[model samples]
Target: MLIEVEDDFRSSSDKAYEKIFDMILTGQLKPGEKLIRRKLAEKTGVSTIPVMEALLRLEALGIVESIPYRGSRVVPITKEKVRDWYALREAIECQVMRIITRTLTEDEIADLEKLANKLDAMEQAGDTEGEEFWELHFEMHMIMARKTGHQSLIDSLHRINLFRLLQRAQYSATEHKNQIPKDNHHCLIDALRTRDPLIAEEVMREHIYHSDSMI
Candidate 1:
């Protein structure tokens, strides 16, 4: 039943959306890079209609902006924007951590550890491109929100995470470096496992804002 639901959400247009989203998050599509519908359609192996649909979706997510004469452009990253995102994340996720500290299951903790391990291995294996890192990083945070048993919080965090991904991509490209913090996920997982809301909240707040100085 769950598998069917997941499959139903993935459609032909979703392929285009995922491809375009990946391109933006992986920095293949630079900030302020112009998005031409025909070129995107060709790149995603989809019709122009679906490509346009995907662009519309991305634009609604605040990842793609439309220009009157220039079509769509990837939103540029800025220190102010990154700070705003971190502030929002801290506001929402700190409360989420409070719930998780009391409610996170042993199974969830084990899964988070595995994710952190995989991320560490990827970094050790010279994952300079950060494609795998980006995916796992998003998954780790989403898992935390999911374990909180709060659907609304999960949805809100998902939107913020998407915006954060764009900012991260642009920051990495502009600085010519990956901004993934070292072992931050491991520290966060450990804090969650402690079953102490204060500890978890502090760790999460620090983890989310760790990049603030760089911005």
Candidate 2:
């Protein structure tokens, strides 16, 4: 039997966590917003304990900070995070692009194009409400990285994705002052489809660097 989780237990906390996580992701919860215990519990429809549990998890994820006897708050954005993530992402994505270009099959590239189309539709329809674009976007990166056949590197990158998402989301929400270039994503896939890892790496780095500038 597939056991369904109780809606009012620790699952409540998990549910609360997910809601809070999305709020942060979607820019609903701006940086430094205090997460009051009673308010969070009432807002999330979970108990205070579950809300605290949720906040604890966010803190562990480096997205939340606790205040003494008061409550937790979302961490404010810092340029250092943008700088650090740009350096880290450049290194990881460059190697991943090389791996992808070397061995990814034609069918794999086709699948990526399909994913890109979905993302394009989302972008065009303005459906990027929260994490709507994240799953597809992250998978696009992951598909290339996974082709490396380096499980350890892939695993490490997965851990790093939290911060990457944070930085990108923060940039999009709290820092962006203009529209993202519409053609950059398509151009990236074009480079990959042509089996040009050099251009592919360059485009990915450029995108990250561009995001850094906006942040």
> Across residues 36-128, which tens digit of lDDT does each residue of candidate 2 receive?
878878878888988888899888767788878877898776887657766877788777876687677888888888887777666655666
Check candidate 1 and list the clashing pairs. none
For all predictions, the C-alpha RMSD in Å is 4.6, 5.6
TM-scores for every predicted model: 0.73, 0.66
Cα lDDT of all candidates, in order? 0.77, 0.72
Cα lDDT, model 1, residue 159: 76
State each candidate's clash count.
Answer: 0, 0
Candidate 2 stretches greater than 4 Å from native: 1-9, 26-28, 67-71, 117-136, 146-183, 193-200
Best by TM-score: 1
Candidate 1 lDDT, 71-131, residue by residue in tens: 8999887777777777888888998889988987798789889998787666555564555
> What is candidate 1's CA lDDT for residue 115?
92
Which residue runs does candidate 1 get wrong by more than 4 Å?
Answer: 1-12, 42-47, 68-70, 117-129, 173-183
lDDT of 2: 0.72
